[model samples]
Target chain A: MHLLVCGGTGCRASASDSIVESLKQELENKGLSDEVQVIMTGCFGFCEKGPIVKVLPDNTFYVEVKHEDAVEIVDEHVIKGRQVKRLLYQDPEKKQSISDSKHMDFYKKQIRIALRNCGFIDPENVDEYIGRDGYMALGKCINEMTPQDVIKEIKDSGLRGRGGGGFPTGLKWEIASKNNADQKYVVCNADEGDPGAFMDRSILEGDPHAVLEAMAICGYATNASKGLIYIRAEYPLAIKRLKIAIDQAREYGLLGKNIFGSDFEFDVELRYGAGAFVCGEETALIHSMEGLRGEPTIKPPYPAEKGYLGKPTNVNNVETFANIPVIINKGANWFNKIGTEKSKGTKVFALAGKINNVGLIEVPMGTTLREVIFEIGGGIKDGKKFKAVQTGGPSGGCLTEKHLDTPIDFDNLIAAGSMMGSGGMIVMDEDDCMVSVAKFYLDFTVEESCGKCSPCRIGNKRLYELLDQITQGKATMDDLQRLRNMCEVIKDTSLCGLGQTSPNPILSTLDNFWDEYVAHIKDHKCPAGQCKDLMKYVVIEENCVGCTACVRVCPVGAISGEKKQPHYIDPSNCIKCGACIERCKFDAIIVK
Target chain B: MSHIKVKIKEKDLNTIKQICKSFNNEPKELINVLHKTQEHFGYLPAEIQEVVAQELNVPVAKVYGVVTFYSFFTMLPKGKHPVSICTGTACYVRGADNVLQEFKRQLGIEVGETTEDGEFSLSCLRCVGACGLAPVVLVGDKTYGRVAPDGVKAIIDEYKK
Candidate 1:
């Protein structure tokens, strides 16, 4: 029996490393180390119940494990051959012990394609990766298929890029192949600039070899001898594993010149992004690589035509490359059959913000937002009323209750004012202010702007200033019209994807939550009580029972009243810090 | 050779080595090297990117792509002390607007602006995850949470010191 402990970064932070070590020590103390193999694996997706410990063969799943319970796990289960009933994950609804991960509702609907190796293999170990047919796709491509054949297979799969743009992956490879440049390039975009998105990072951490092998395959197909993986510096763990994978692949003859005795020669290297949002644009990325300012040049001579030292290049994000090996192994038809006609295969999303299950999830393209939010994501947090869902991070828009049933696809999401932006789906609740949400995204976009283009540089600034004015209750109806007009101008005239999609949040919120903006403008009130400038905190006399709790908790000394006389919030002195409201047990503080 | 009068030829390789060495020995240091290089050089040039890739044993394109992805690290050389104000939900509610106004007022520069001296660069963050103490301003490593408009001067003074 093998004991798989979650070694994903999140679980690692929660002392999972010590737990694994203790489990090993306990097994050794019991003289069962030889019989039981303890392996450290990637994220189990059910992060709510991590540091998760799963016993394989019988598939006994244990959640929220501590270092102290390591002995009990070994003594009760390993020594006595009995299940630890108390340690098993209890179904929240049924209140019954769940024996296996498959039985749990969280894992019942999740179809992990990109995340297949995660939570199953020791990411650092090359053997574990190989044991699960890791570099077999590279082997197959090198040994069996020609460069054109591999490209043909990818084309037949109908795989669209997962990095927001929905560009055809096979077509991109074909373009780079058809180009008669002396030098060509294959770039793996692991930059993942989208907020709340950790899909690329997780893939690199859990299954680094998959991306490496796929990059090698891409390199071979494109006749490019070299491949580059461009990832952000923020993802330290992913970078480490990717480095290990690259070295291991090179050692195994899967990477570097004359792989597997084939005439095809290919190798890969790592590149770190300093974190520029505009660099996610292919042209800007190419320009950045060219040692120039990472500003987007107009595309006509696309990256595939003249890129990276004016050579043909193909760029795909981490997720897009992660799907290649699977497509090669399972055949194009199998992958083609999974998702919608246009958007084939599963998409990995970092489901976060006001959601119960805030973790990485991979589901088919056609899966409704309801299923993702409810079934996969375990619904909204704190049982709050579902207001809207924000997909595609800063570049994407917000979707309301009416659009929850709409199938998640490239075409469908764009139709709904949201695009699949590197798969960051932030769930929103009723308590969240729609105007505030738009402003938040605008704030991110405006800051991330490269400032190379006028529309993005000047227009986004103007848009943000207006939103700031509206949030502060300083804007009129005409300002809202100006905001809308500026959004179009920026969207149309922007040079890069960052500027083009910068107004998504503003446009989406304006389209769906126009009333909220109207309320902020005309009524001079924030319905969600989110806008602090427009909010006034007052203590209800009937509810207050001489409680000094609020007065003591007020950070700015905004609350004042005689004992039992019901406190009054001086609006001039009050910062609207919400300390009094949070501290009040009697619901005395009313925010209007 | 005199310290300040090193030959241009030697300086190029030294700069490349200096940039490459910043990444440490780890092959994964490609991204870190790129960030540091970009920090030194305003933007990543193909030659510099290639030098980093070659020195770190990584590919040029990979370095190029990483330079593009994140919002914090810039591929281009930016002014020192990237002053980021927290404009997240918590901060916005706690008069981050006023704090931002104070920054623009004091610096004579809007958000995402660099001063003429290139000493201070200003930008805004969605949230720095320090919501309990809203209106946070991150000047380099130090985060001055719960910052008020009146407090901006004191915070800037501390940085100046």
Candidate 2:
């Protein structure tokens, strides 16, 4: 039996590392060290119940295991081959312990294609990666199939780019393959800058070899001699693992030159992205890789034709490249039948915000928002009323309750006023204001705008100003109409994807929650009480018993009262810090 | 702006030269060289940018432009223990803003500014991908997760030495 402990960053922060040491010490004390192997693995996806340890061969999953429980696990289970009842994953609905993870509600509707090797193998050890059919696809592609055949198989598989755009992956390869360039390049866009998304980072940390192998396969297919992974410098763990994977692949002769006795020469180099969100755009990414300002230029000659130092280059996101090796190994026919009609295969999402299960989930393309939010996500946190679900980060929009049943795909999400952008699905509750949400996204876009385009740089700033006016209850009804019009103009005239989709959040929020916008402007009240400038902290007369606590805590001296009388709040002086409310013994202070 | 001659040590300058040489002195490797240079020296100053510009044979304006365009490249030096609070959408919804404000109030410095003594500096990162540990605060490389406003004092106290 093997003990697989979660080694993901989330679990590591929660002291999962110490849990591993304790488990190892216990196993050694019992003289069962050789019999039971303790291996630290990647995220199990059910991070809500993290610090998970799964006993293999019997498939017993123990959720929320502590360091002290390590001795009990080895003493009871490992020694006597008996299962620990209390440590098993308890089903939320049934309120009963589940011995096997297969029956859990979270993993029921999911398909783990892109995340196949994520939680299973030791990423540091390439032999373990090789043990799980790691390089079979690259070997098969080079030894048996031709470059054209590899491209055709990817074409038939119908795998689109997982990065915001739904462009066909194989068609991109075919274009680059057709281009006659002495030096071509394949770039892995691991600069995952989406605010709440981390699917790429998790994949790189969990399975670095998969991306390296896929890039090599791409190198063989596109007739490219060199590959560059333009990953973010912020992802120190992913970069470290990629370096290890690259060095290991070189040692194994899978990456250097003439692999499997064939004349395919491919080597990869690492380029760091210095925290520019606009680098997610292809042209800007290419420019950033070339050590220039990461600004986007007009695209008549796409990156397929002329890119990365004016050579034929193909850029695909980390998640998109991860699916390449799988499609090659499992045949096109087998991979094509999984998802919806147009969008074939699964999409990995970093499901976060107000959701009960805030972690990475890989679901089928045609799965509905209702299923994802209710089933896979385990519904909203603390039983809060679900108001909207924001998909695609700043480049995407919000979908409401009416659109929950809509199937999630490239076309379906676009039809529902959102796009599948890097798979960042942030669920918002009733307490989250739509106008503030739009303003938040607009704020991100304004900061991230490369200033290369006039509309995105200037228009987005004006749009943010308009949002600032509305959120502060300083805008007239006319400004709402102006906000709508400005979103359209920015959408139409932007230079790249960043500006084109920057207005999506505003437009979608306007369509779905126009009343919220009116509440902030006409009523002079923020519906969600999020905008501090619009909120008025008032001490309720009936509940206030004149404890000078509020007076002492108020930073601006906004509250004053006698020793026993009810306290009164000076609204103008109140900075809306909510300090008075926390200090009050009775629930007297409330924001209006 | 007044011209300042901020001196760089000879050894550090040689390291930067070696880094540029590793990339064949190609102007295209400007961003890569800057990354390595910044890693060696905690932050990039104006003087180092001039040296990088001369070494790679690119214009100083271009190097400065590349440095300013990316958020990761910093012109101002970070504190001894830089405090990065994640303000990503997930952390935002989970009350990371309050934690950030609490730190600012305690340190008497706003986001992106260092204290007078240079003990700590405050900045907001997009996301560190530790969503399960919402409202994460990083002091140097140590991560403090599920950080509440009340927990801010203890964090600062630990780094007081």
Candidate 3:
């Protein structure tokens, strides 16, 4: 019998480490240590009910296991062969305990291709990775196939880049292989800078060896000797795990020189990015890896012809490489049969923001947004009304409830005015103001713009100012037209992908939530009540019991009332802090 | 990118010089050197940038430009306890703004500023990849998940002593 404990950062934060130790201790005391094996694995992707412990062979899954329950788990589940009824995952709506994850709604719809081995194997242990057919693809590429044949297989699989831009991966490899350079390089763009996106980081933390093996296969295909992984410095855990995986692969003679007794030699090095969001662009990422300011120059020299000290280089993001081994193991035709016509594989999403199941999820391409948000994500949090879902980070746009039934793919999302940007599906409820949401993304873009081009630097700043004005109830309807025109100008003239798509939030929100913007402009009212400047605090006279609770808690002394009389709030002095609302027990304070 | 007038110890200066040498004093290793130096020191001050520039044979203005361009690099020192609140999309929808305001009200400082006693500092990070714990707050290395605005004072009080 085996007990798999979640060792991801989320579970670790919830003290899954102690639960692992306690489980081990209890099993040893029971003399079942020889019979039961305790293994710590990566993220289960069901983080809403994390610190998950699953007993294998019988497939008994436990949710939210506390430290003290470790002894009971051993007493009931291990020794006596009985299940812990309370520890099982109970459905929020059904109120029935689920014994297996396969039957759960969260896991039933998720087709785990990129995350196949994430929660199943111990990442730090390379042998465990190999046990799941890890480096077999690298061996197969080196022994059975030539460089051209490998690229042909990738082309046949119709695998496109998973890094926002859906450029064909095979075409990129072919371009780099065709270029004649003495020192070609393979680069992995692990600098995942999208806000609310953790797909790449989770993959690296869960299965580091998959990325390394794929990079090796990439090296054999592209005739590259040195590989560099440009990862963000913020992801210290992923970096540490990748370092371990690299050292182990080298120690096992799978990474270094002449792998599988062939005349192919390749190795990978790590380059740390210093928190630059613009570095997600390939050229900027290349510049950052070279220890520069991470600013992008125009393409056409395109990393393939001249990259990394002026040598041919191929760069693929972490998720794209995670799929390579699978495509090689299962034939191209089998892999290509899934997903939509254009986008031929699955996409991993960091499903968060006002959602019931806040976690990482991988679903096949062309899955409707409704199915992802409702079926897999378990619907909106707190049973709030659905407003919109933002995909592709700041560079992407917001889609309303009308677009939920639209199939999610590269072309389809673009047609709906959003793109499949590195799969950050942030679901927003009715509480979120569409104007404020656009302003929020603009604020991010304004800070992250590299100042390389005039349109991006100045245009984004101007766009942010207009949104700020709208939120503050100071904008005229003329400013709306200015915002729309400026978005097109920036999209047309920006230097990198960052600026070209920076105005997506504004464009998308304006297209879908036009009425909300008009309400903010014409009536000077924010329907969402999110904008502080537009909100007014008033005491409902009928509900006020004159308890003086509001007066006592008002920070600026903005509320006044006589003993046993209705209270009044002086709006000018009220800082809009909402302190009075919290203090009011009689429901006297109303915000309009 | 401007520098403050401050005295620097010779030993600390040598550590900075030694780090540059380890990278072969290459101009392209500026970002890597900055990352390592920042790891050694809590934050990068003007004196450290000057030493790095002198070692790498780059202009002082260029090093400052690079430092200020990236949000990761900081010119000021952090407090004994650095508190980073995630304002990612997940956290924002869960009312992280209120949580941030509560921390600011308690610390008497803005997002990037440290308290007068240097006991605590406030900053905002994009996402720490722990969205399951939305509205997450981190004091030094310990993470406080599902933080409410009402709980901000207790978090600050725990590190006060």
Candidate 4:
């Protein structure tokens, strides 16, 4: 039986590397090292229960496997062919252990298109990638099909850009092809700057060769000889894996001159994005690649006509590119039949924040939020009520329980007041404050604002100040009106996509959770109890035994009372550190 | 943006020149050059920026603009063990703010400030892509996952030696 261990960043952080080392060492000790080959692969998307180890042939899937469990895994599972009962994924609801992951509902509703080879193949080994028809599409495009035919195949596939904007990918390639420039460029936008989104990073980390191969295919279709992957510097692991994949592709003559023994040459270079959120925009990305400040320019001269040193360029998101090879391999008719009428394929979502199954998931276009959250995601964490789910990161808005049944797609999300951003589906529960959540997004947009335009740079800052006032319980209803008006103006006048969608969080929250904002404004009370400025740390008379624990624990000396008597927390001096609450045995100190 | 600079020794100047030369001193390689220089030196001070500007044949103001534009480049030097707390949306919702507040309380330093002893410097990052461990902390190259406000002291106490 073969062992596949998750080497994704999430698993790596939990010392999945040591788990592999111990597994290999233990296997050697048992003289079964050759018999049982341990392969370190990419993310399985079930990151909540990582580092995951899947035993092949029998299909025994293990979750949260520790390094010390290596001996048991090798001794019990691999040796005697008996599955490790405890290591198997225990269903949170039924509390029954699931041996084969194929039966789990987590993997059932999900249809992985872009993430087809992610958890299945070893990212470092090019042979494994090729074994699964990796570069067959590239060869087919170069030899069997013409550029026009290839573009037509993509167009017929009904694939749209997965990077927030659902622009037609084939139309973009056709435009770049028609530009007739002396030099053209194919850019793979791996700069996933969305705060909670990591699907792009996971794709690059798990299947780096897929992106490289797709970039080559894009280069052939667009007549671009050079490709640049503008990746985020924050993703060091993705960058490392991409570098390895590029080197391996070059060694195998898949990326270098005359790829697949054809004249259609394509090579990729890595351009590091040094923490600029605006760089995710096509214009800003091209400027950053030219070693300039990542500022967005007007869009009439889109990147298709002028980009990357003033040459014709086609920029596609990483997930979008990861879908190209699949669409090329499977006919457009086959791929288009899966999703909704408009959106044609599965989208990878980094499902996180107050969710039980906080992991990466890829589901088809028409999959409702209720299905993704309740079924695939295993519902909200700690049995909390599902408050809202934030998709498309800062650019996208907060989708509430009412919209959970809405089918998730590019058009559906936009119609529901949110757009399909880089697919960062952050589920927020009742404990999370909507007013504070809006303030959080406003804060991010204010910091990330490029200061190029007045509306986005200054108006966003003013909006943040307004949010601050609301959260601090100092805002009037007039300030709330101003916040709404400002969000509209910024969206209408942003020079780039960053400023345009920056106010989405505010607009979305105001649209869905208007009561939360009103509570923070009118009553000067935060319904979620998240606004510390409005909270009062009160000592309950009966529970407070005046044990002096809270008084001693209060760092600001806010609590004072007689020993064995009830204590009182002075509101003026209370810092809301919650230290007294932690120290109190009776749980008397409560925030209201 | 802070514009902090230290005295640049002659050998340091040579190192900056060499880094620029390795990338053929291309103006387009400015970001890459700065990344390499910062890897060699702990931080990118004004003196190093000037030397990089002169070698790359770009204005010093341009280098500073590029340096300040990206959050990765820093003008001030970081402590030996720079502690980073992820303040991404995932971590933020999972109570990263309380953990950050706890770190500041224990270290007696603000987000961009270093401890007086220069042992640890605290900073907030967007995300490390480890959403499974929502409130993630990074000390040097080592990653600490699912970090809580109560676990801040034990993490800092690790590098006490």
Q: What share of the true interface contacts does candidate 2 keep?
A: 0.75
Docking class of 1: incorrect
User: Candidate 3: global Cα-lDDT?
Assistant: 0.91
| lDDT tens per residue, model 3, A1-592 | 9999998888887889999999999989988899999998888988888889999889999999998999999999998899999999889889999999999999897888888899899889999999999899998999899999899999989899998999999999999999998899999999999988999998999999999999999999999999999998988889999999999999999999978888899999999988989999999988887777889999989999999988999999999999999998887898899899989889999999899998899999999999999999999989899999999899899998899999899999999999999989999999899899899889989989999899999999999999999998899999999999999999999999999999999999999999999989989999999999999999999999999988998867999989899989998898888878887888889999
Clashing residue pairs in candidate 2, if any?
Answer: none
TM-scores, all models, native as reference: 0.84, 0.97, 0.98, 0.99
The CA lDDT of each predicted structure is 0.80, 0.90, 0.91, 0.91
Give the Å shift of residue A429 in candidate 2.
Answer: 0.5
- Scored by lDDT, model 2 comes in at 0.90
Give the DockQ (2 decimals) of all models.
0.12, 0.78, 0.76, 0.82
In model 4, which runs have C-alpha deviations exceeding 4 angstroms?
Answer: B1-5
Compose the digit string of candidate 2's lDDT tens values, residues A37-108: 898877787777887889888989998889999999998898888889999977778899988887887888
What's the ranking of the predictions by TM-score, best on top?
A: 4, 3, 2, 1
What TM-score does structure 3 among the candidates reach? 0.98
Model 4, chain B: what is the TM-score?
0.95
List model 1 lDDT by residue over A558-587, tens digit each: 888888788888899987767687789999
- In order, the first chain's TM-score in every candidate is 0.97, 0.97, 0.98, 0.99
